[model samples]
Target: MLLPVVALLAASCKKMFDVKPEQVVDQTQMYRNVNDADAAILGLYGKLMNLAKQHVVLNELRADLMDVTDNANDALKQVTLNNVASNNTYADPRAYYQVILNCNDVIKNFQIMVANKKFTRDEFNQRYGDVVALRSWVYLQAGIQYGTVPYVTSALETIDDVKDESKFPRLSLDKLIDTLIKVTDSIPYKDVYVTGSSLVTTIDGYNTGKFFINKKCLLGDLYLWRSAFTKSDIDARLAAGYYKQVMETGGNGDYDTYRIKWSEVTTNNDIAVGYWNDGRVNQYSENMLVDDNDYGWRSIFARGQDALYNTEWIWMLYFNASFSPENPFIDLFSNRGGSYLVKPSQAAIDGWDAQVQSDNNFPYDARKRLTYKTLDGQPVIMKYLYNYVDETTYLPTSLLNKPGKWFLYRAAQLHLHYAEAANRDGRHKIAYALVNNGLSYNFDNSPGAGTKRDVTNTQQTFDPETAYQFDARYGDNPTFRAPWHRNVGIRGRAHLKALPVNGADSTTLIENMIVDESGLELAYEGSRWADLLRIAIRRNEPAFVADKVYNKLVKDGNGSAAATRARLLAKDWFLPFKWE
Candidate 1:
């Protein structure tokens, strides 16, 4: 008897928040034609849209600016609360499993198609390879976020379809790493041709782009996952081996390749696999950007014309308006007369200044520009804000359109991975070099340009030779200098310094540096919480604590003060797990 495909694939909803699949395709029909199989694959991509949306919430809430402790006393005040449970609720494991089911369907149907002589060997292999890679990608997200997830290689249709959910406990870190490695090995390294109407086609012709998995990016992701899961198990040999693979595959031996891959505006050789959201046509952008005046929560309040942008955001799901009208980041950063939805925190600004300055010994080195702003004929560096805007007019078609793709995996992060691995494996020199090299990419030694006051120009002038002198004069006191003048002057002091050649626990120091760099480099890439968890686990940090005191501050009659105070309570910060 033929098993019903719906029985095999329909997911059992456990929570009210679970999104019911709007449409379901029968497995029998799924493999009968190329379009059927292609549609199944498209479903996998559709599931990825959830990842893009989740990323925005995760990045904004976890960044230094948002207070994780706050919960609105009433529905009105809760709008901006950074409650972990609320965020975690949005990242439901079942939602991820739904995506996995789509991938499983693709893999299963592709196998069936090949067996039935419906697909050639080349077609089967290529399609099978894509499915395997996509499945691995989904598992990586699940494994990293919710450790020891149920590994389902087949689609689940009915309640009985879920084979031994209780029996499938969390896999060990070593096992998880092995699984990812094997998955990566299965994908073909060579390029594959894709011909189809562009999802964002402005005209009628199909817009085709060559697609293939870069061994380096895949391996880099593997290493990152490995590092995340098995920090203690990481040794020098393994670290060097993986890093060498990344460097060799990267072609550009320089570390810049890893860093630049994070740019949404540029898509070249570095990316392994990721989605692009052009505002003009992407559905996700439409949901986020289009004025929802007729229905839902957005319809009640002033419809947010701009989405969300945080200078702290390192890697984002980008939306290109030329491709789609719903690009969210465009509205978020473009100052089209909208209320600035996101603002850099004072702490983040201070951190940016610190990152740009030179160390006392290394006077010539430049620092990373974490954020940027224009003020008083000088550019004030804001650590989180990367894009520049000229006007703040609220119009759908404003010139403030800044379109850049979101980076899933960046080169700078890989360097940090190398540094961490080196530190873990007792390669202090290598770790230091990797960290410094990554920081060097953002340094600028050129004199100030644009409407510069004489004093501003003098202070903004970045001379490698005099970097030490500048650090000494302005390093301790950042406030003394004008905001614009201070931007370049502090580069020497702010940039991460190289590790000491000898220390009691050089490895630990390297580890700390890696953690610090992770915080500095990936401040707003939906990584802070993960980083915090990793550090807590590695360092055995006692239950999280809140450093800020809310009572000392005054609040307007609005519940902002109480909300802020409640947010400051460390105990209430973490997500309350249903099981916990």
Candidate 2:
């Protein structure tokens, strides 16, 4: 069910340039028309969408598990740690290049048009601006994911032209970032045409300014990239400056102010840049969360009665209602009983019980609430849940059918990022405050937030200890503990996870705290892998230690001390290049 927009565009380009066409237009003749330039720009956007699809899969694959334990699944294991080199066939370097190719074509073709004076001054600026911005975006994606990648600035029309690819050697990380910044500067933020209808004006105009790339999105992305790169290489002050810019540009604001009601995403905002199917309102949510009998099309990992909601997903890619069958999340959570596969892990169950106990103020700040459910006994945050399907029949109902919007960037994430950056810069107090602000948004305050209910002043109140004990009773049996039971504390009482007050300045402690926060605040949002890698590099943690604990039921599996130790020493923890 992957989209075929790229294939179609490539085919169209070949047809346009083919010698055998019924009527051929030479390159000289093509740039003479304004429509030709417009078509070229539109093709760039089409390519952007195609690239986005590939990213969605890559994001999920990075943290995806085989059976709930920390051990790599078939897909991840093949490309990540503890897997055979022969299993590396799934990594698709070409998918990224496809985007780069489109960008190269736009840049090259647009330059030709500009040189020929084929467009008016305004037209030339607008069209050229978009292509440049898009090119920068494509390169940024490649740089972030693959680190040093081949930089192809020119488009190739034939396979033979790409044979001497060595000529386009990998660019250093610093050089790539500089190049991206230069490209970004050429484009005007406010003037570019948006893809959808305008929100302010009622008229159905061409410039909607809602979903298209704009100044705010670009700035936010630049800030993120700069923050990442500077965290390791550049001056701390430079990173701080970038983060300050992000906060000032409306990147850090209230979710309710921008978020669409009932949906898990916002339409258009200063920080938000992209769109995705919000499973919360979409049929996928209803089918996956409510209708357990229809487990055939849910996500493969979190399916059936074992299906769980991911509260940390800040941005989820959109899936067409018609394409529900192809969405793995939909099939994984659908309730066809045990038809879907995957046993829960012991580590996960233990983690769940610990979270429930900590929610009621047991040992200390409970990190589980950030990543899992509360300990008391309330339903898990249903940010991705919907009630549109009949529970017994597992059929879709009109009441629950709607498309969910994808939020590219969110204020909460900005806060967390700011905290990390601040900590890196030795601003411990600022980082702690920012982290608290970010956590404030989703804190719970009810008795049954995580565990069992006890009689209170007048009504039944959830006793956190009771809830923890309940989960402990079923820790060995993954089948008994429902996903909702995992977060009973979320609905009960408000509590924030404790930040490292002692080691705020210590690089090791700061790195550990940041990693822990990311796990809590960004888990299952396709961020775990990157977070792990960044921390490992930043803290100099053992590369492949057996200390890692995945949330599956296997006794002494990958998360066991031995396996974690082994992983810490292994070089395969980082993803390998498809060929090397």
Candidate 3:
């Protein structure tokens, strides 16, 4: 039987906040100091971590890149088939609202913490901004998963308060996005926690920085969604502006830090290998029996969380094996010592295989090897092989004992998002360069005055606007070594051949490349559906998303492919909210 929303809310509150009457205390006790404030914020992240599997599954299974295996239960199959039932365990909206409710509690009480002189202005700003951004993020995800959700800002006191439909009416996705954009734009502390802040410290042997949502990145995402919804150049530029701020702010105002460098490659006979300069070897090969250090592009996932990974990942939630809730992905994707519930779709596998690497010796993307591989004749997701002793062996006797990661944002995604915004804003070539090659490569190759297009200009036409320019000019002049100069295009870094840019439809073509590259670079990372949805909404073309999902289902020999496409074309794009 389906549970009512009130039952869900009540269960969440009872689990999260229930206490005996003697132990129940006032807000003043909880907000006594910064330590208490920090505890509250950390508690929110703990709750968020509980929802990680739902976030990844809803965003992925409902889209095209991932598919359920024969072992997958009814809930998984239903979501993949685009026929999600109200009682599907994965379809629960309560977890999302539970996080939102706590955020409301924090938001409401933090003010009292400040008014009582328990927190300094700086402390209040930093902590309050985080909770606000996080709450908006959860709400945005909820709105995306469900077509409409009750947008409640303040924490409701009783189950009746939550059950009152008139007081907390559901808001449509469009209105929800507008509300989020407005709320996020006003966040006072848009930057990360300043150095030495308690929130920046390590917890349980992991740096806490990756746990907090980035305000600017969230703003960029909000504006990007708004731009898609409105199809407005102004909103697109606003999104680009916020994204640029994130890229520039990453290395303490030095953009060069995050830009992938051409020098960061393994050289063979004076030729660049397009792999990370890290010394780790790529042990996962067709001939290799055991997967060793799958470095290069895969290091972003394989390597232990360290300084290097932080450079790329803006936000990631880590689940410790010792923690309360175990890693859900262990059973969902792992084929070793776990229920292999899902595997990479054939369409996604073929998409990567179709690409030829920049080295020209390989016809497939090396990343595909790291993304997923055949183990014992079964396609297994290799990315989440966190506790595996080798390619074919898993170390943990109990799969639930293994720790897993939930990826949220990263540098490559940042670049692609900015490119999306800039492209819609009419900076087509700039957008293409970001996907295929770095800004400097295009800037350096721009046609000289009166030079023939074939001779001096092998590159696509460059936009001359200062805003579109990345200023990659570099040499003996130390001043020229700016951040944009170090940018090797996203595909360039991946060692893939640059998809040529031309024709009157260049903007659309580049946008499509961005989406495709996102699939190749970020598949199974909880973004495929949102990326498709955004583009489909922007162009008002249901076929854009429908065809992708259709192809996936078709390859699986599902009879529902045509029906799913028809439903999507009719704009029946959201999961049903039938809680009865």
Best by lDDT: 3
lDDT of 1 by residue, 1-580 (tens): 1212122222221111112344444445456655454445444543554565345444434334332222212221232343434334544555566566767766776777888988677667666676676667667665645556666776556423443657455564447657877776656632233344221111112121211233444454566555544564443335445554543332333322232222122321112111234545443222222122222211111111122111111222333333222334433333333323343334444444454223223222122222323433333322222322321222344455543344454444555666565566555544554564322222223322322222322333243322111210111122323222221111121233433446454776666666655654555444554555444444444232122213212211224544544664433433332221
Ranking by lDDT, best first? 3, 1, 2
Give per-model TM-scores. Answer: 0.57, 0.58, 0.87
Shift in Å, residue 570, candidate 3: 1.1
Candidate 2 per-residue lDDT, tens place, 379-452, comes to 22211222323433433344334322233443345445555655666655445544442221222233223334
lDDT of 3 by residue, 1-580 (tens): 0111111112112232112234334554566788777767766776787788888898888898899998989999988877888899888877887788888888887898899888998899899999999999999888888878888988766423554678889889889999999888887788988668776765556666677898888988888998888988888888888887777765534544455545343331111123432345453233431223433566576566665566677888776655545678787887777799999999999998998876444788767876787877899887777444353454445544676677888888888999999999988867877888676566555422222223222232344543354655544322345556557788877777888765654778888989999999889989888899889988999999999999999998888999999988888888876454
How large an RMSD does model 3 have?
A: 5.9
Q: Residue 500 in candidate 2 has what lDDT?
A: 36
Residue 300 miss distance in model 1 (angstroms): 36
As a TM-score, model 3 comes out at 0.87
Tell me model 3's lDDT, rounded to 2 decimals: 0.74
Q: CA lDDT of 276 in candidate 2?
A: 32
Error of 1 at 303 (Å): 28
How far is 568's C-alpha from truth in model 3 (Å)?
1.0
Predictions in order: lDDT = 0.41, 0.40, 0.74
